[model samples]
Target: MTHTTKNDPVRAGLDRRGFLRRAGLLAGAGTVLPLLGAAAGPTASAAGTADGDPDQLFQAGEFAAAGRIYARQLHRDPGNAHAAGQLGYIDLLSNRFTRAEHLLGRAQRLAPDDMTVRRRLADCFVRQDLLARAAPLLPAAQAEQLASVDGTPYAVDGPQATRVPFLDVDPLPQVRGAVNGGAPATFVLDTGAMGLTLTTDAAQEAGLAPVSSTAVTINGRTVTTYLGVVRTLRLGEFELHNVPVSWTDGSIMAFPDGTVTAGTLGTALFYHFLTTIDYRGRALVLRRKTPAQQRAFRAEAARTALRPQPLWLAGDHLPCTPGMLGGYGPRVAVIDSGTLDCGLNTSAANAERAGIPVDWDHPIPVNGGTATVYPATAARMSIGAAVAHDVPGTVGPTPWEGLTGFDLLGNFTHDFFKPFAVTFDYTAMHLFVG
Candidate 1:
């Protein structure tokens, strides 16, 4: 959430007393129950109702709005560790390392027992490529592993730019990839993932051994995964060395043509360059994030009439942008290229608030099971400078919000990006499409 925007009216419309009441900060009467811990103030709701309360908004995937409210609460109560920590988390999501350090440090000082805050602080350091700074806050085993790679983590050696031509483009973007000089296998370019992810079959085929193990949630199910490092990864014309990777027992996907997708190349790998998933061009472009390269890209964009839209690196790697649902005010939205079926996916409350009626009588099929998801047409929708009317989408629970710390109003899927040649400028935190 930003301090200023065209949607500032939504923030202005909320008076102090009403905001406090909705936030459950007022006296007993009309008090709403807190969603999580009592000390952290109010949080969320059940399935059907949509509350404008900050906590409810946070739980309902309206993170930008919730963040604005949290900022206000922090302004009023400087000692509120919960508020500070939440702001810090938002900063971490935005890739504002210094701001996250300050806020999380203050929150840690106020509530020393907050492990979540501490972990988030460590994550901030890790994202900045400072393993030494993050070591002390991590567990002994993880710290030791980080210390081992303190000298050179994710070392890269290649040209300034490389293009990985798509091998399969039906369900998602796939390319031929290899690990540690292993045989080439089909891999997905999934932006939803953090680092490199591999299936157990692929890991075995590539002869990788586990360095550590951790629990992760995939498709609403928790699964155990083994972490390892790739001595070298071959993707198109580039080579990345000393890269951390994780392997799980789960199968990502199998193409109808009987091609097995072995793994994924995620943000941790692409953040080193100005990456572009050119669906129209049928290739993944990786350009070095150098001053000359950025200047050349800007010049090309101007020549081609491509508009650059501001984006935030949220959570581990989600590219979030300000967007509107139907006619509702702008909120945080993630551009997730991984979602294949729908152009847009959102929460029921947000859909209802935006004047799109949810058809609870008819449910839709999802990956795990059937859900209260239905097809609907948004009268008006927008993300950054891109706008559309009568857009098709799906409205449901949106379980992925948990992965992103409930910091999104919806997800614009690969279908939404298929028409353009999209470029992600990580350095400037901007997205350009043509």
Candidate 2:
């Protein structure tokens, strides 16, 4: 497909939203890496082995252990900028915004030229609702993202706990919502995406006006994107106000019946609520993250025989967990809600390590490129007590390997955990499956 361009400010073509639909970047294919994958982002550097080095452990997705080592290093050598930065990164992943801000700020002062540290600090400021302080350090597009939500960030306007029944969508979950009082439109619950994104038609129907504009490079191809604010978004019994949104002037993905999804509800909205994608119950539940609510959830989980596993949020909104694929232990597993069709996706290096074969001669088209994808079965895949045997998945080269020099062993899709009710407790940094 040829890339499309547009002249209208609010109708830019092939932005991140369009890129996602075309490249399947969030579907574990890794055709084009995340926004964090640009020139020498935080996780792009490597130091040593996980045996004693914090950098290696951090790259290995062993965040807890890496934090301990980095803390010790920082204590012994107070000027250790790398140690401070790594600790800050860990805290950011764990959602300790204030602590992360302090550590990252210190790291930036020590190593002013480290673009990675500066980027992480900017992100920390944004997370703390200090957009003005972060805007200068961000790129044009991301800076515009903050500006869109400058005065009025996302806020809930109704009851604390709201339940929205999922519309009948296969593989991925969808719900009916309206933007700025426009007609109701369908939105997918895409944890793989960072923020809310709408199609051109949806934005136009809502009468959205562009507030910011910039160009972003995807797979070495530049695409123009515009930012706007969604004054109100109605979902079920609740509503969200002043949400930042980006859209493409062109159409997104088309279904078999010639229908198209309106938009996507990503992590940006879910971060404000204790989100639960109740697959078994056929609903999306959102609750305030209060201590009382946490206690109630713990009691309920105990009664339901659901085990809590550690989950960390990495670059942007990527939710990562520790899991095993085949015989490999402690591999980084991403719980990608955007991925459908397959249960798990593993890198070609990991497949070879697990003794899975690949037919390189037969390449399949992906993200406007050819990839040698092969099907294989893992003897067992486990995340905490939740384990599946004889799991079928795919193997191919992934951009993640090039980004971190670490092979990502598992990318778990929504269908893989469809039988359980999954809850992401960001406040507690835990994922519970029942």
Please provide, for model 2 over 171-214, each residue's C-alpha lDDT reduced to its tens digit, 9 standing for 90 to 100: 47888998998888888786766667877778788998876654
- Maximum-TM-score candidate: 2
Structural similarity to truth (TM-score) of each candidate: 0.77, 0.86
Q: Which residue segments of model 1 deviate by more than 4 Å?
A: 1-78, 138-150, 215-222, 250-252, 355-362, 370-372, 377-380, 387-392
Candidate 1 C-alpha lDDT tens digits along 294-398: 999999988977788767775445677767886686777877666544567787788878897656666665433424467776777776566666666788766
lDDT on C-alpha atoms for all candidate structures: 0.64, 0.67
lDDT for model 1: 0.64
Clash number by candidate, in order:
0, 0
